[model samples]
Target: MKFNNKIVIVTGGARGIGASIVQHFINAGAIVHILDREFPDSFDVGGNDSVFRASGDVTNSDDVKSFIKGVVTKSGRIDSLVNNAGIIRDNMIWKMDESDFDAVIDVNLKGPWLMCKEIAPIMREQNNGRIVNIASRSWLGSAGQSNYSSSKGGIVSLTRVLALELGKNNITVNAVAPGLIDTPMTRSLPPEVFKKLENTIPTKKAGHPEDIAHAVAFLASDESKFINGQVIHVDGGKSIGANLH
Candidate 1:
């Protein structure tokens, strides 16, 4: 109940880390609205009347504008916006297809950009808002994920830029860069590859979706009002630099 009567918007919240984020906000007493391309049949909004779900492509400007308008109409104001919608098209630069790169960049970078553009005016008018963008630790570097890495790196930059622009309006913009979290996406990796990744973590284990959600919830709360333009890595110290001994 930390966010009683608050209005929060989470994009790509139908499953995995996004889904976990929606649940956390809902549990914290926020009126949570989710925008996703599609909701799985098994996905549930916990029967919470405060929870709303809409299907739309985050990359579509028309779709993003419509969703924002709908949320404002129903909730009157938006207190927080979580840009959690992202997609990965992993490949070495040489092996990657142009279309794959375009698809990943469109959804991962462009989508968040569109969402922020639509929400900034609302937050500025209110003179208060929280924006938690879901970036990735891969922004640092990843061998087979050139497109994804670049897109996330762009998000990191975008978060910083928005923070500077929106600070005067009392809006805080931050990002949570998750490492190896156990989600459907990661679960798709071959067992050997997944296990290898887990072992590479400083903690010798992959993080859970809730771990990322916890960090996001903190960044989205009033307690973090003073914190802005920062990237919080919920990556089990994987971003701490390699172990050299």
Candidate 2:
């Protein structure tokens, strides 16, 4: 777990699962660069010299380019890129506005795609790198989440294609499909709805952000070099049978 001297960038690192991933890498001794629209107002990212924060929207290609450039300027190299920045605009397919679908896709899928487009060349030149995309089990099928589901599905497909395209350059690309993680996003869910969702899980427990972070950390590690083009589920078995209820 020691990432001594490693340089990593995590998009959406200001909150929730992304924050957990940043903290994990920072604790492991990596020079962590975080890209977020803004740091969460409540928490503090102080006291860590190895942690660098960049404020910008991931959906903007220019912002992503500048952030990656800044990371290279400060860290001297890019060892890993966690494409964790995303958003959800949920609604039934028939009820969903085109804008909702486009927004979700722009942030969730296009944002990561753009990050990869910018950072992959750096990795290729160095001949070593890891890219982990944060996706969701909702991609399987979720009512009232047409926009969100489509975006995540796109992530899975993008991960596989990137793996094939990047492996030749000694870069590994993978993804984590998380489900029911306890985070600011889920905290906004209505109590009754959240409870019912939990009740359906075999684990009967919502996942922590760290649950997903651990998977991303592993994928980013050298130990997982051969495990590319795969989407590992961190859903407490939810993908298997957590919804049988």
Candidate 3:
């Protein structure tokens, strides 16, 4: 389970679940390349040399290309890619703005596509790679998350397609679908609403970012080579029909 000098790329790694995933790989001795819009003063790397931070927008093709090229030029290889960059523009379809929907789709879905497009060839050339996408349980269904849900649904499909396309090259593409995770984004919810959502989970409690990070790490590990085109729900049994009733 140790990466031991492996090169790992993580999008949206400045904070929250993405940050946790970055730290997990770093702790396992992997050199982590993090792409995020900003690293606030609070998010500290503590002078870690194994970490590379890139400030760029995932939705932009030029930015993605430059970032990947830089990583390749410096490291000469990319061992793994975690497409954890995403945005949530939750709202009922009628209430949602077109811009919000586009923004969500661009970041959550298109961003991953762009990243995969750029890295797929590198991995294929090396004949080895792992890709773990951070999808959402809401892809199953969420009342006020049409945009978010659609974007994640797209991720599920993308993972499967890539798995099929790259399996022969020793590349595996899989997804981690998280639910009720206690992140700053979830903490922004009103206490009552957050508690209500937490109660709906079969576990009756929220999960930590580490829970999802662990799943991502497992999927990115060599042991998961045979397992591809799959979506693992680290959702406290919520994907099995946990409900408010």
Candidate 4:
């Protein structure tokens, strides 16, 4: 029980990587609070009575604040924050609309920005905390994803800057850049496109949300106290070389 007695907040925890992260933390004996617009179907997570659900939009300041306050009211303190809420709007820069870019940025970038703005003070007072931002490998560059890539790239930048500013307070900020992971979003892709994506990964397969969760668990735990301000790539070596058939 690495996270025993800890309280963690996970945004977008209803599905995908966020859900996996929530379950992992709960399994490790941490009380997990999920901030998301919708709740997931009932699933047993360690049977420890460690799961808390808060329904709200991460992009809305009021919603974010309320969710945090609710968590604090129940848990007294937050030991870790995982900014995992994100959205994708695929299109080239020339074709992308201002609203589309803003929507993606609002949720993917500004959402976490607001979370930190509200929660960092609590962490500062506690004199120790961990914040893990979920970014994407597409931040390096991606075709037809100007909005998503830019939003994720901004997360990478935010992670490093926050780590620097918060380190003195014993708060470590880090980002996890995941490659292709099988999720509801990717499941919608055409079979041909999905196959191409798999062929490109060095592992010849897409990643799983659990893979990213494992990385996050380590960063959120005491073992990674020395690791900070890093944008860890959870990709399966796909970032090293473009998948070419």
lDDT of 3 at 54: 90
**TM-score of every model?**
0.98, 0.97, 0.98, 0.96
lDDT of 4 by residue, 77-156 (tens): 99999999888878778888999999999999999999999999999999999999999999998899888999999999
How many collisions per candidate?
Answer: 0, 0, 0, 0
**lDDT per residue (tens digit) for residues 56-136 in model 3:** 999999999999998998788999999998888777899999999999999999999999999999999999999999999
- Cα lDDT, model 2, residue 1: 80
RMSD of 3: 0.9
- Runs in model 2 deviating more than 4 A are none
Residue range with the least summed lDDT across 10 consecutive positions in model 4: 39-48
Q: Write the per-residue lDDT of candidate 1 for residues 1-245, one digit (tens) a residue.
A: 39998999999999999999999988889999999999999999698687999999999999999999999999999999999998887878999999999999999999999999999999999999999999999999989999999999999999999999999999999999999999999998999999998888989999998999999999999899999999999998999988542
lDDT of 1 at 70: 98
Clashing pairs in 4: none
Best by lDDT: 1
Candidate 3 residue spans exceeding 4 A from truth: 242-245
- What is the TM-score (0 to 1) of candidate 4? 0.96
All candidates' lDDT scores?
0.94, 0.90, 0.93, 0.91
- Model 4 / residue 215 / CA error / Å: 0.2
Clashing pairs for model 3 are none
